[model samples]
Target: MTTVLIVASNVPAQPAVLTEALERFKGRGARVAVACFFDAAELEIDPALAEIRSFAVPKEQIDKRLRTALGRAPANRKIWLHAQRSGWLMKWARTADLLVAIDPRSVHTVWEMAQRNVAASACYGLVPALRALDAGVSAPVTTRLERQVSATAARGVRGARRAAISSAKTTLRKATGQKVMGTPAGAWLWTRAVSAPKIPDRYRSKLAARVHDSAVRAGRHAEAARAATAAVSRITNAATRAELLTKAAQSELAVGRVPERLHDAISAQLTLADSLLRKDRKRAATALSNAWSLASNRVLHFDRLSSPLVDDPAGYLAPFRASEAARLLSAPRGRSVPAAPVPSGRPLRILLATLINDNFLHEIRQRYEAMPNVEVRFLDLDDDPARRSLARSGSSVIEHKLAGHTPYGEKIEEWLRPHLDWADTVFIDWCQATAALFTMPDPGDTRIVIRLHSFEAFNFWPHLVDFSRVDDVVFVSDHLRDLSTAVLPQLLGAEAPRLWVIDNAMDLQRYARPKPAQARFNLGMVGVGSVAKDPRWTIEVLRHLRRQDERYQLLLIGSDLNAKTSVAAKQYADLLKRDLAELEPSGAVQRRGQTDDVPAALAEVGVIVSSSVRESFHCGLVEGAASGAVPVVRDWPYFAGGAHGARTLFPADWVVDSPAQAAERILAATATEEDWRRSGQAAAEHTLKTWDWTVTQTAFDRLFLTD
Candidate 1:
């Protein structure tokens, strides 16, 4: 009997595809074993057909520091690193007659398996596997021991060569990773290597990025910046220079430090954009789009505690404003036809769209779906794998906008034009890629309304969005509106859309569950997914409260922070893990990881804390408040002292400046069960009356209902 091992990076979207393939294999007298990166339990199959195993490496098992360090490696390499450790996979791979990769992500695993099991036929996808089986090769006479010996010999030779190369690289990398990079000798050596004659542009850029990452890690920012400039200067092509510079900037930003050459990278792209504008408009738009992408990277702005763009919007984006190509990109590409009037004859067709975050859209969708006068369709841009790629970058859309043609444009037209024709209004939830893609082609009488929450104002996405094509721009808060308009010049222009500050739709009624008297001393925080959430600040508050009364314990709800998102996130998570280690063991903090029933969880808490450094809207805090949890909100620093801030958004009593102040507020409010209940009841009433879906749905109706 023929033996087959099929490795899947993820569960197949259609399991029947795999099941059918398995049946065909079984009919051919093949015994199939399926190894997947996901859980075996999640995939239901006929037990007699195939043996299944999971090779999923739990997030907690992977060393985050190592993962962060390998951030620049190819996706395949990342997958290989995790899967290679599974002994079951090794044994199955060695014994199989044929190895199949169910998806692209599993191809590398199969490739590696092919190297070890030289006798096995490795192929990707079911069709390829079937073809390989049809075009059968003679079975190898080599025994398992002989194959292992041959594989070992091959690996040994390759290993020797790799080790020599690795040794040299390690020596160089270590030097850069230390304070040595700051020294004249280290700088001289790097300068020589980067500027070495006959070195290919690709090699030079690779060397520069490596050295840059190392230097940045070592805190030698100036040296890293110098190395990047010197390396890019050696590369003659403008595109190559811009690409290298952008990578360098991204590398720095990933680690939570703003590169000194970030402005230089943006300037390089602007120069390239201008050069391409006269010769090739599409390439120019792409260059400008890339510049905008770099300038607005979340790592540089929103994901961090501070943003240069937020500090001085006009100043930070001044380079783009000065560039002709950039100006062309942002220039009004007005709609071919005015937005169609909301038909009195039929229900108003509205499409609600967002990339990934749909937390705030639940209520809007429900309200509109329930409305007799409205017809709603929800489209998550990230839902479709094909559209997700298009929504990832603005270059393709910009190319289409400038040249009037692109594959992305055609695909978008084919995919979205149907929805555009059906809907009288498209309410895109974020001023990001989804907004940019939907607005790439003229709306043709379909009103485009995009909501800017918080992060988009700090990123390049809003710049890509055609404000002129949009009928209305919505903001969750006045502060977000002010910040967005200040950053995006098009929003300030005459053709700018009607700006509206509409609070996010939320159902607060479910959060009104009664709490026990002991809940008065229980503090809670709902989300801690980002560094901007500043969970450490919440910990400090808990620490302060614990000094007064150890009965005050923190209930941390929601998923743990994702350390893999960025270097900053990793560092923050490390700190949080350390804090949790101390508090959790002592029973001072309870980490009730992600749960579907948030309202039920909130019932255990008396106080809710919003410890974010920046927030357009603290939804978690609001939800908690609506759950009869007294809110102690840190005056969100991004807009704290601005014209509008958390202080203005919430009641003056609800907002505080520091952990000490937050702790003080919590203590005072929860001094007695009566006081705690009263405080929570008042806060709940305020959120329900002001920000709840019942109150906000009318504003949404007006936004769509208006001509």
Candidate 2:
């Protein structure tokens, strides 16, 4: 068997690409294994594949150590530390038949690994991996010192520019913090304490902590805050007040102390979050967490001001409730003034459309688009800047998320109705604002269908869906349906319309690849960027495997954690990065970053793991399974206990909890190379037979094509 080992960075797109290759290779008895750092549990794999395990290297632990070291070290030494660690990473190199990198950031590590693993052919992207495999030879490509110098210089230029910008931000934040919190009394203590030279670095943080506490205890919060601000302000530090405030808030909350100037804390953190979000939106999630912690503070609810939710639900929630963010979370509905028959003109020009994610509508659109029976117009909410409303919530752009959709929502209805009036049916994707807006009123004679994905259940959009106008609600999974029903009982109310669970339209025919000789050893996961897509758990599995044998390593795809965006995000990112750092250099895990192709990445991944806490339908895992990667599922804690979840989505043998169980399964499957190859072929067949778009599109056709 020509064995293929995919070194992925846990990108979400990996599964789809892999599934395609598995189909082609399986009939030929090729072996495949996917080794990655992120979780792929959400991807419900076909049971035919061998059991999959995660080769995760907990980068968070090393990152934490690095952060601790950085916190203690002089700023000049950070780069030196990173360079010194390259020597520490050589042990994890893989001698796979093929190596594919899923992201750009991971290219460096992959390049290093390829240098030592001369038997392995390395390439970026699933397509590239496939090409390398087709070449059937491992050619050693070397990077000379001159080339490294050029690359380093280019990177230095980029880093220099980034550092300059970061310095400016830091300076501004420190200045703001000093102005906002500095007090003469507290300043006296800080000035003397900070100026003391040659004090042990270890004691520095503790000393600073003592001074801060003294100021707080003395009822000089502003003074204490200002002191820290002053210390940080002048150094062109990127860490700003919002970051400080969050740290302060976290400490206070942990000890159960609320900031005296709660409003100041909230606003300061929010403003900082806004600024950070302007640059990097992902980090804004933490800003929301921080804001929530503050707003949900007892003082705001009971200690002082009356909650807007309690006082005036309509007016208070106006900012949030009226936002496109909230609207996207709801079901679709039409107005009370509805009953109109299709006019006796041209054939019903049904307009089946959605905002952007048309996963469910692909087949339905094609069917209707080809229906000689209708006229069609598909609108992506993101296509028009005016219509897109979901920005990072509460980042300075919150006002935008709130204010941005009102007119646009109306314009949508205006632009859409004419087509609705012209045609008969109008299908919208996601129960998001697109659905809400389309159903804002009666669509003269048009029938409307709105699909509900998993996330919209946790949010507010389902509450806004005017059931009065909606004709159908489509769901991808049953657990989502059950949870959504409980979350929004309005569906059980008089206005509720028809709701159905339709599988997503995925063309999974490509899986069915031959396994390589060492296909039994690798474990893979797809997607690792979000908190929801937890990669840490996968690390635990790898840890388990190393205890048995150190042959396993994880591969992560996607951007590294960016905590600089918000305190909450930073905290989480910091933790995750720490986990990655420890695991990465040890060769226990590899993070590749984001990529477009998956089949090539899957070429090397023998096993696939899903590690999400929650999900709608983890298309990634299913795609991985289709690619013939042994699918190991986490049972999906978010949707596990529900009626429809990972259990119902995939065969029972595939699901498990904890990394130990995952390791046990991987060990058993890899016990023999022959055992591994058969399992992979079976999985590829299952994915191709079950989830291919040809099969799923039928469900779509039934949902949209039916009267």
Candidate 3:
């Protein structure tokens, strides 16, 4: 009997196709063994027909550190690494006459298996598997040495390619790493080298990224930017140009700075997107998706100190907004029926949904969950692998939006329609993928409300949300609402949902704690993981204050910034670390690690500083104020001169323009214990009255309780 092995990374979408193909293999007198990453029990195939087994490594079983290290490897390499760890797969892969991959994700596994078992026929899909079996029947028998020789020859060829690439990279890095590149002449020479003749496209791109990275490390941002622009301009292939420009742009973002050539990078992607649209809409959507991904990357636009989009939203995104394909994706699809009012005699079923970041929902969920008249269910879209994959399927989402029909659209309906059916009202937090997916399908009578926090305004997700289908679109602040509406034109349309500004829910009553007299000398900043938080500015404030009063010190609360999040983050973190090393030993600055009790942490903090370059709302400063700390809010630069800003959001006395002003205010506010305590009392009363859950919940209740 012939032996066959099949590997599937996910459950087959159409099991009938797989079952029919299996029946064909069995009719040919083959014994089959199936291995899948998902549970075998989910499959309906007869056990007597084939021996099925699961190759899934449970979450607990996976070494997270190892998985993270393997994450950077090629998809095929990662698949092989995981599969090789399974003894059952190794055994079957070696002896099988044929190997099959049920899905695209599994194709890598079969590809690796093919390399190992050269004698066996390997292919993807049912029809290809069937054909492989026939080819195997007529294949000439191979000796063990022949198989080994072929495998060794393949390895030699792959090794040679890898070695050649490695050598080229090493050579390029050395030539570009010279200090001479700091000057214009040197930069021009290196730029020419990158654009030199006989250089392969792959090598040239890699060289550009490496040179830009090295130049940035050498602190030559302008030089690096110029070199990348020159090299990209020399490239003829639009896709390759897009890739190189994107990589260069990402390098700048990695260090917490905007790319000097961000406009060029974005334009290249839009150009490519438009090019692809003429030939294939799906491909065009994917290109637009790539462009959006680069433009909306959190490190560059949201998590950083500033953004080009915030500077000029329409101008920054002019290329994308001009693209016909991007417009199609943003085109509003109105819901068929208006949301039905909450039934008077029955409990209202409300579903609170999000992909991740449920920090804002705790109070709202607790309130609804405790209410007798309301039943609440929370759906975290990222909590499930299936939904998570769907949420991240940017290309598929674009295709669905452009075509008005796709497998992805069907899947979204199948997965989310049940929740829509059950809930009288659906509140989606964060106008990201969850909001887009929820709004993709028509809501028959269910109310759809999506809340856009600060970050989503800077991302492509808000553009993807079909505002016409939404009943209420909420923002945390007027500034964020203005910014979001400015970028997403759909929100401005007459058919758009009712816009509302709802402050984030916070239980500030708990933060009303007394502080020690010495607390007046301490300045505290909560949450400093992103470069935008501008913790360095707080340090500058500390330095400025300490010169006058040595008693002044800064308390940096929350986890240290994670450099691995982006190249920009890593660069910022490095600079911060060096600065911290100098001040930490002298007690001028202290890193108070993350904690659950912000009130307790703030009790020792007399002055709470909002040194962020930008914010929708400085919740941390408010929390600190609620804890009896004097508030010192920086005039967030992004929105400083705009229609709405930190100045408009907070009392004028609390907002400062510069570090010197912040230091001046800090000194004046805490000049005496009485003045400090009095200022703290006033700020605390303001936050409690304006933003506390006690105050905000009423607005929330009106949103849900009112028809």
User: Using Cα atoms with residue i matched to residue i, what is each candidate's TM-score against the true structure?
Assistant: 0.73, 0.53, 0.75
Q: Go through the candidates in order and give each one's C-alpha lDDT.
A: 0.83, 0.60, 0.85
Clashes of 3: 4
**Which wins on TM-score, candidate 2 or candidate 3?**
3
lDDT of 3 by residue, 1-707 (tens): 78999998888888887788788889999999999788888889988778899866776778987576476567656666788888888999988988888788888888778778877877788888788787663345556557668877987898799789868856766777746566667676776677777677777887878778767766788778877876776778888888899888877776667788887887887788778876777777877777887788877665556777888888988887887778877787787889999889999999999987898899999999999999999999889875689888777888788788888899899999999999999999999889989989999999999998888888788778788889998988999999988888778767778999988999999988778999999999999988889899889899999899999999999988877877667767888998999999999899899999888999999999998888889789899989989999989988898899898889899999999999999889899999999989999899889898999999999999998
Q: Candidate 2, which segments miss by more than 4 Å at Cα? A: 1-348, 356-364, 385-413, 561-565
- Clash count for candidate 1 is 0
Better of 1 and 3 by lDDT: 3
Model 2, 1-707: lDDT tens digits are 66555444555565665667555545445566554445546444543442233444345656776766556555444433342354322333443555555666455556655554556667777667666666664543453344445556766785799689779856644433444224664457564564366654334433444455555645456666655544433323233445454455544433335554444445554554555555644354355446545645442322221233333334433433333333333434345455344435665555656666665666566766776656677777667675465311223222223333454445556655566666566667777656655655466646777778875654444554566677778888888788767655556666687888877777676654555665566777778655566677888888898888888877665566444433344445667778777888877787767777776677678888888777788888888888877888888776656567888888777888778888887777767777777677777777777778877777765664556
- Evaluation by TM-score, superior candidate among 1 and 2: 1
Q: Put the candidates in TM-score order, highest first.
A: 3, 1, 2
Residue 650 accuracy (lDDT) in model 1: 90
Candidate 3 displacement at residue 24 in angstroms: 26
Q: List candidate 3 stretches off by more than 4 Å.
A: 1-190, 193-235, 251-257
